[model samples]
Target: MMKVEPASPQYFRSSSYSSCHDLFYEPDCPKKAKGPMLCVKQPSCSESNFDCSSIFHLQEAQDPSPSMSFKQAVVLVVAVEKLKKQVQTPIHFISDEDLYDLFLNIFEPEPIECETVELLDQPEKRYIYRNQTIEYSIRDIDKKCFLLQKPLGSPRLTAVHLQGPDAKKEVKINMAFYMCPGNPTQEAVVLGIAGENLYLCCTGESPPVLTLETVDKNVLGSMSSSELQPFIFFKSNSGSTCRFESATFPSWYISTSLAENERVKVSQLGQTAFTEFNTSRS
Candidate 1:
């Protein structure tokens, strides 16, 4: 003895209801408005003719006193018909590769330098790619691995030293740098890490400021290519950690600060903190 109420035109258009079948059931349509209670005979219900308007007609023939007006019934019928059309529409399915490509298109990252590397020791294959300031080491572990370390210094000028347990063994591997095709800018270089792109932009304003910002490709390309310098990392005076200094901006060095929303900045040679970064490996 459950009573089902017909939904309005607005309800039919809403995304709240996914299919027309959900409208006829009292349990699914819990929020009922005050109106002629459309009683649906549960015993006579069948899958073939389960529409709300049809059920209302069957119930109306049985109980004539409490009934909807001709105009109200027409609206309900039209709404039900629209819902039926939406439900019957063919759904186009896409492959997993296609879906992935679609997502990549929507969230394409700004172009940055990338390189691929293969590890020789382990049974599982490893791939190394440079993204911004750090290099990522991806393995067959079903997850992403990050590997960061100081670049090896020149053997001729400075003797290369190793301290860890593996230092005793000489491990040699082939490496290649895949330079992204772009007119290099002297003012700034794009830094990418963890899929985020940042530009080391220099503004020739008062104080000769440098800022890291997320800028568009064209804006980054417009900056002075001649002034841009490769990021150089060197061991600190303590011999324990390293710091980054810009090649072009001789006296300016990259440092991290505690200011809100301003974590990275370029400070004058003698004024910045002992900014240290980890060389992570997967």
Candidate 2:
């Protein structure tokens, strides 16, 4: 058995309880709220396996302090202890709200902002590569060339001067129109190449329950996109991060699993865990 340490003098204070050393409360408690009165500290296991019986002395506070009555204090202590036990219980399945709450409590999260990049010239036909670049040309399709569109949706409209063979073709693309907020400009609609809709699907199964896939447009028009299941992209503050909060299931985010396939799914917002890469053109 491990040895238990004695209670420190600083942890104890005078009270109307049986003994002055027996009376104690949470340190640094606010003056407005009555501090949770507890008995002298007792040693037990580590914090990971807190021995509440040894730590909490749920005895009445003899002095009738208006801040918290003895009855209220006991109820609070009981509630806290009950919650602690519930947390320790093994969880075979987790609800979206529960998972989100767990993550929110463990890792406080920040709101995501939008990042839109616009192109200077429009191409007759545009192909968005996963590598964060675009291939377009006004001339023959055989002469298609590449242009780096990293940090997609750049606010500035830069001018590109091409000569000789390069000048033979014109590239037209409006990335800003697709990513920009609100209604798209006439130029954007005419020149923009629509991107595939992304989804973080979950079936509550063993593997690959949470996976990333694009919406299949081949389906019959009679069947709505929702019927086929499509997860829409929600913007955030960071440009590189693909932060996905489900509109159907609020607070839940798209997370990647460490499995061999690197499967994806909806989970609580873990600053690091739930963050996935942007599969779409940046």
- Residue-pair clashes per candidate: 12, 18
Model 1 residue 201 CA deviation in Å: 2.8
Q: Candidate 2, residues 103-212: lDDT per residue as tens digits? A: 98899788999999898763322211222324223211122222222246432111233468855333243222122123222111112223433223443432223443
Highest-scoring model, lDDT: 1
- Cα lDDT, model 2, residue 67: 58
- TM-score of each model, in listed order: 0.26, 0.24
lDDT of 1 by residue, 1-282 (tens): 112333321111221222243344333343432333333324444535434333221122243454445655554565445445534648788999998999898997687988998886643211122323334221111111122222363111111233477343322211112232332222222333333344444454434444444545445344343423332222232253334445445556555443222334566656634244333232
Which residue ranges in model 2 land beyond 4 Å of their true spot?
1-216, 220-222, 225-230, 237-239, 258-261, 276-282
Q: Give the top-scoring candidate (TM-score).
A: 1
Model 1 alpha-carbon miss at residue 158, Å: 34
